[model samples]
Target: MTATTTAANPDAPATAPRYEISVGGMTCAACAARVERRLNKLDGVSASVNYATERAQVSCGPDVDPRLLVEQVQRAGYQARRVDDVAGADGDDDSEQARRVTDLRRRLAVAAVLAVPLCDLSLALSLFPELRFPGWQWVCLVLAAPVVGWCALPFHRVALAGARHGRSSMDTLVSGGVLASSAWSLWVMVAGGTPAPGLGQGLSVVNGGGHALYLEVAAGVTTFVLAGRYFEARAKRSAGAAMRALLTLGAKDVEVVRADGTRRVPVTELLVGDVFLARPGEKIATDAVVVEGRSALDVSTLTGEPVPREVGVGDQAVGGAVNVGGWLRLRATRVGADTQLARMARLVRDAQQGKAAAQRLADRVAAVFVPAVLALAALTAAGWLLAGQPAGLALTATVAVLVVACPCALGLATPTAVLVGTGRGASLGVFIKGPAALEATRAVDTVVLDKTGTLTEGRMRLVDVRPASGQASAELLAMAGAVEAASEHPIAAAITAEAGAVPAVTEFEALPGLGARGLVDGRAVVVGREPLLAELGMAVPDELRAGRGELERAGATVVLVGWDGHARGLLAVADTVRTTSAAAVAALRGLGLHPMLVTGDNAGTAAAVAAEVGIDDVVAETLPADKVDVVRRLQRDGHRVAVVGDGVNDAAALAAADLGMAIGAGTDAAIEAADIVLAREDLLVVPDAVELARRTHRTIRGNLWWAFGYNVAALPLAMTGLLSPLVAGAAMSLSSVFVVSHSLRLRAFRPNR
Candidate 1:
């Protein structure tokens, strides 16, 4: 995400400048909402804070100082820094995340070691009276102190910070439970004398009538909660692995072509317009056009295609693509942030920052969830006291209520699923814009496909070659190819490609409206339309004319190849359909999407292409400007449409549709206007993109329901004294782990063939 802030001009109107602020010290969804509220309170400032990303996207009036925004977040008791200034490099966020994971692991290990002995001793004394040796409670106290104080310090510190700012969070509830349990146990040890043992006693908190000790509750709860957090942090880090892999694909060093031979330099130092050489098995330094040599590039890392693309001089090569054949000398057209690889990384990061609508509702609920649980705990304690229950039992029920109700699960429900889903999609060659686009995919019932460049190859190529009777096919093709090579038309190129290594031509003559004429192997060859053949006093045979008509009816462009005063052969060429287009259309039907073709080609040609691709509905002969009208007409008829195209003419229609998917090999304008970009040329990825979105959205819904349902059901059990505080802590932690683990399932999502 990029943000800009400039000096305010008094005479001009105030423009809202955007900024990204990296926020720290947020422990739950409520913390993010609090920071958002505080930032939004300023005049003419609007902010949205994402807890998953730990960044706030803020838009404020030009007159507002960005530093003032930082001060407001700090006042709310959190660390704040300008993202553009601090995280100017890529690896900074990864390093910070790694540091957090290590710290959590250390804390969890300490808590687990101390809690085990403390809980064992307390449980033994309560269950068996013979195990209650002299000063056994002192042994329990000694073991529990460090577990409650040092091991749980992170929770206490965050809770104290919130208290200072007059706020409450998930950590506040945890701290309250730990402190209450540990303080009550200390009092029992000091004032109540040696506690007598009881039969049928449960583990954790020990109670013998008037005197009840809860050192085990304090220690056990702290350890279990820490373990949950440790695992949760590791899961979150794994969710971003795809993006990290993408960053690693670039070349570290480049061979810069200099006046004094070629010099080796860091990729960062390579500037635009500099020429670079890439040998076999080397990655392209940046986005560049080939200036010398020829090679076949393996672009699977970028586009997910296994086939290597053959490229000669003047072909564009993207950064991160490996040259697998021969050598290539390239001039950099784009470097640094201007390259496509950088743009892709930015898009992925920006997509992760958006929150779904359900997540927004969950955040609102969590913002007040902590305080509500506190109130409920107070009521539970008072009700139990009034109902003739002992004070010890009532306190135990209240502690359970505080520990059982978890807002952490509610905070994690949506963002984790989105992170894993988007990352997995990027690996499979699908780039979703954000949660909104993923949501849009769920409702799309119709897919509007542009015929050219989408289902078809978009470039003319050889389809067939026919030779006249009593003529050698090779000799006729060689003469025609030599004459047509002098012309630069699409049909001529196709013929030249088919007749590989043809004999050279001399005395080539250009025909503007027709094809060319040249002397090949001491023979005068003329290749063009029938008019060119007739102009050269050449008569076309009846069989070849019938053959040309047959090819044209099938949507192929036919051209006559003739020499020696007669038409010798008919060559057919057309924009052929992709091998995967038929299966892609079938897959769309399986997903219950009605696919149709909308293009600028003639009705006959469009219909033939549609039939080949298994699309029954066709809207042909429409102008490029009229494509948007077709989409609007469909929407008016109650269909949600997704349009896929790959040209500048399709940009408007793509933007006008409900969901827009751009082909990866498409123009820049089309890619920019799209909601989802298919990074591979294969049409099969289109269905994969839709299926992944539907599956991800389903996972998110499941997580939200589980999170909300667990709290609603567990709180009642805790309030009724059926659940102990130690058990409540375990359940609460498990709820968060389950939510994160459920989201991680998206990493295994496979593309539907």
Candidate 2:
């Protein structure tokens, strides 16, 4: 079949071969475009670049060599390495992030410096009649050009790049407005005569029949726009700083021992099988097994726990963990880019870059917004020109349409709100993956919660003890604790808690499918399930069986204790639901979301927990794969579902839900799958994040409406020759300021209870 199909389609062009290349040294929007341009110029290649993500997608013909493309990028002053896939690439380091921050800071400084003279000159020319210095005005315009050309180049470059890709963006709106206004004003000033043919008549009427240079208008707008972009860049940088902070936790330099001697090298240069020595109070530089020493190491940076853990020869130490007690020699098992810290940095980056569905909607809207506005402006200007207006009036109308219809305010609305909201969320110990996750929470109708480690305290605790026919409660607990003392299960933890100060056991044996048997006070003691006791030929009491039934109904697990060949007592243990769970569910209900509990436990246990949390709906004994089906069913039933969990088993459901939230300290896989990770492990934070996102979303919508309305209403008045360039510029600038001030309201918004 394949041979026949190939013979039939001989004239068809071959499928484009795809190449995944890791690009380096891309510092800004311009750098991204330069790389794209350089790559596109290569024979048999096509490329698409995303500057914000620092990634490129390339497709080429079979004749092209991927290695040659990478080498070409390197020769052009960037680092490029071919890989099987770009999606699996790791994030950059702190140094790379720091360099980007520095670059934005420099651009902001230049914009600030240029804005000073531009604003001063423009304000003086508008407010004071006699303070006009033509030379000073020209100086301000000259100063503004460089600022717009250099500091504001990203907007223009991005606009051009978008145009090349057959799309339009915010950059297109900004670049068109500033360039048109600036070029027109410069022409009038240099000629020192009547205004350019199309603008002179309008100027003649507005300034009372004399040529007027509106250079201040151009300079002022450019400076203000650059200032806005500078702050916007800073806001983005601040959000990225969290990832940088994580990366900075790794050691930058490490001490290495070679056959000759010891020396220092960058941590990235370290390799597996290399041995390194660590002294007391020093951190381990890589993941390694201790070769010749013992120490109490602090692994809190990776685990979030505070207590130091003891490690001896043959034990493994993770990289970035501190060695607190003694010196150690370690053989590197994993080093350099393979360390846990590096993996964590990569995870954070991946989480941030994963755009939510809501953001995609916003992007789709913005993609067509610029060209539509441009067409509107052109039509508005043509309508006036066809109405017998002079060339100058037509030109003024065109400029007004461009300036007033600029999407600067509309472009800023959502991103500014998201930036501020994410920053505040991070401070509150909430990690929202992206705008889509934030928005989904607002519309969530059902909340599926994990039972273990989320609704309840994950630790198992003994709730009750029942005495056998011939034994005291205290005596039974002592013997049971002694047997479980050497065990490592949750039941063992409970038993140890009850033991108090029991005598230590000499020998212990853990029965895999049953229980534990150990020598306590030189007697044979056993702790296990009923089946194990039956296998040991012990008789069960009727009262003990009834007690076990009651414990099971209350969501507790019952264990049997025996000494020699007789039944001692029954011990009951369960993980109790949190006290705050009821209130958190009620809060979600108050927000109009119906809360549901999904658990892997039996129906009785699930119902008990659901009742305690005031939730009426419960799905019990759900396997991990089945959880996604439950979520899908809820969605099909007209509910926008949000699934919350804290175990590796919950990961699939988390990704399947409309909004996936991982609660408590969960596994990395669960966190990666979630749209929101509640760092504080409180169910209440879920409602809090939802409330915050809704408030921010409302603010962004309000700002966008105001921005669009202001421009739509003002542009027509300016275009009909009723408003001059000076007035139009002032109105346009004030409208931008209004949008910004409106967005600042987000700083004061408090999430509702």
lDDT of model 1, residue 350: 68
Decoy 2 TM-score against native: 0.62
Which candidate ranks first by lDDT, i.e. highest? 1
lDDT (Cα, 0-100) at 312 in candidate 1 = 90
Candidate 1 lDDT by residue in tens digits, 371-416: 9999999999899889887676777888889988988889889888
Write model 2 residue lDDT over 7-92, tens digit each, in one string: 11124344666554667654333344456667878877776444444445566768888777787666655667765422223344
In model 1, where do residues sit more than 4 Å from their true spots? 1-15, 85-90, 194-210, 461-552, 556-573
TM-score of 1: 0.84
